[model samples]
Target: MLFVAAMLAARPGLSQQASLEEKWRALFAQTSPAAAEEHIDAVLAACGDSPAALRKLFACDSAYPQLGGGLHRRATTVVDGETRYDVEYVVRVPGGYSPVRSCALLLAAHGQGGSGASITAMMQRGLGAEVEKYIIVAPTLPGPRRYAGAAYQEQAYLKPLAWARLNLNVDDDRIYVSGHSLGGHCTWHLATMFPHLFAAAVPMAGVPLFEGSPYTSNSYLENLANLPVWAIWGELDQKGPGTLSNVHFCRMAAERLRQLGNSKFEGTELPGVGHAGWWPKPEAYARYLTSHKRLAAPEKLVHFFHRARHGRAYYVEAIRLARDELDFSRRPQPKLRVQPGESLAEAAIRTGKQVYDKSLFKIWADLDKGANAMSIRASGVSAVRVYATEGMFDLSRPVTLRFAGRSWTGGISASARCMLTHYAATRDATAVICNEVDVDSAGKVLVRFGPSGGGETAE
Candidate 1:
């Protein structure tokens, strides 16, 4: 009897029960569908009948089918603060799609006032045979707002991507993003804001928004230095005054990419075409998209954002923004002085009134294992704060930061309580690690550690 019981306990599926319980605990701690989906299959197979609460925990009744490729309309409930939204998305799978084989995924964003159904129909018409080769996902935007702001990127684009990754056998190296018109603007924004998520980007008849301007500036274009960006625009397309022509903007963005030493950037201007011309040429877009694959780990990354919510780039995560408001003059500059034996609580009270101008940024690498140093440069910014982690450098060994004929060498360290406090306030998990330093008056800030370990971690 004992031998028989041991055999049953040693079964492959039964052994996963404990892991399932641990995953459920983590899932409930952060109420996200993506987290739940990570271990859903294993949990369902291992303890589906044993735990009555497991079904309720994941709302498993609403789970969609994972097999048989076709058009699938799925709705997910997303909660932000006190409000809950029933977000719906359309996923079209090729007839040949198989659970055993991974397929390329394309996230298609619709134009203003358009639904996922409409964009899927457009793709069906335009892509023809190419549509069957990839899994396409289109998400509906909430209300009448177009893909004009960060809200659309967060709710519409990112939510659908997360859903597809969880539900489908998506090729992580082949994931791509594309959009037309207003969606095109969002494509640029998403590509820059989260470059690591995409292998390539296609922005057609759209302009990137930057600093209250319709078109992306040269300074902001540096964020896409490591991305393979292909932009398309109609030569005859025009917006109101103070806005540059879409064709001109694409050309300028491509030139900026080239100036930054990116060789994969390309811009195409369609002559004798209007705002809606690119819709019929999905073959061209497909060819470009298929030629590129995502670089899972890159040697260097650069990202800049005005808000803490948009802080993540490829390998670096922004813990805090330079200032909440774009105007630097309005930001409070705190004066620091130690009077005759002031209490710590009093110093904290005084500092709390002042603006925390010290923005924090962190990079994950195992530099101690190799000998190659990472180089970085930024313009049109006051100062940059950088932290190296994941054993990127020997904390005890001296690391040098050189810029503008000046250099600073020191062992980097930060208070764990300070990092945790900032994360508690901003809800940014990436800021919890330590080893931080700040570079003042940044022009070209170079960090000479050692070679990289070539391992990848989240930004």
Candidate 2:
């Protein structure tokens, strides 16, 4: 209703007003600048007093249409009760946008307390389309959010990223992520969180991952090493660099992944890239993304995107269930179905960053093409849920549920010996259940989640 006025308007004056400016500009070839100004004045009067109508006199584009080649829109995505930001992005594809592959996704998150304006400043200073080669997404930021730890990236960059792909012809196989300072730290988490999602990651002058820092574990880096990584920081960065956290973390991470038999990862330490100086990310990060495909699957990439957009709860649980081999000897054939219109041919499974999960099920997610139906087999619990949808997952509501009725009272007890050989069910009281089930790993589930009987827990 707020925009109803513009929606109902005739918009007839736009064409007439636009041509008037064209005629005026043409006159500039033969007449004086004074004459052009006179015509401009005439054009304005013909258009009218309304702002939208008047813009036509100058041949200006409406707010949403880019003046040259970019996207422009303003929407309020309220995060916390007290915080709100203007999420903005500018899409510019030189030739045209494509999707089966994936256009690059760049998240320009800022350091602690820096406004979204500062992030935009960095992008404009050196990150415009000059030599850029990917789609850029700059999420709105609070002036005080930390680059490394502001939970904002998950909310801003991650979710909108899913929405972004919906409208643009983005390459599904190549979404990339980046940031600076605090953003650098956040970028680290992004790379680690769903290591398989990004083709590459670039964090500039980011605060280093200090020794013993809870978030600096090797698990994340191990996950990230599947692809190329480029890091930059000023020699003078004092926040965490005085301690060499930024430079050394990369060193330690590279070494750890190598020890783990990962040889595809690369790390760069700029001799002079400063802690907060404007960075040439388009140049460096661009090279990283185009260099090589990190050797993963499209399903993994889409799953990564799904996790980023949706919360990781279900995604994490699914990852534990994705592999063909579980810690227990029994291998369940249960598969996870992505919502309709998701990608296919998923990537290989990779490790993800870890913290603490007090819940019985540590929910996890990754894109999977090989999985026919996704299910879980745990120490005390086992479950499954099919997405029932197709390729190119939509994580906004990325899940569905399925349940079966069998009353033996309590399901898998915390002490029950439950293993999914292919399917699992139990019909007797006080026992691990493996009732009427087919344990089809390659069978597609029609929903995303299943049942919770007595003593059954999935949260």
At residue 153, give the lDDT of candidate 2.
43
Taken over the whole model, the C-alpha lDDT of each candidate is 0.57, 0.41
**Residue 307 CA displacement from its true place in model 1, Å:** 1.6
Q: Can you tell me which runs of candidate 2 are displaced by over 4 Å?
A: 1-68, 71-73, 80-104, 112-121, 124-132, 148-152, 207-219, 225-227, 234-236, 241-244, 272-274, 278-284, 293-459
**Which pairs of residues have clashing backbones in candidate 1?**
370-451, 371-450, 371-451, 372-450, 372-451
Q: Which 10 consecutive positions of candidate 1 have the poorest summed lDDT?
A: 450-459
Can you write out model 1's per-residue Cα lDDT over 232-277, one digit (the tens) per residue?
8888888411345666566666766778888767878888887884
Superposed on all Cα atoms, model 1 deviates from the true structure by an RMSD in Å of 13.8
Error of 1 at 213 (Å): 2.3
- Can you tell me which runs of candidate 1 are displaced by over 4 Å? 1-65, 77-86, 215-219, 239-242, 280-282, 321-369, 372-459
- 219 in model 1: Cα distance from truth in Å? 4.3
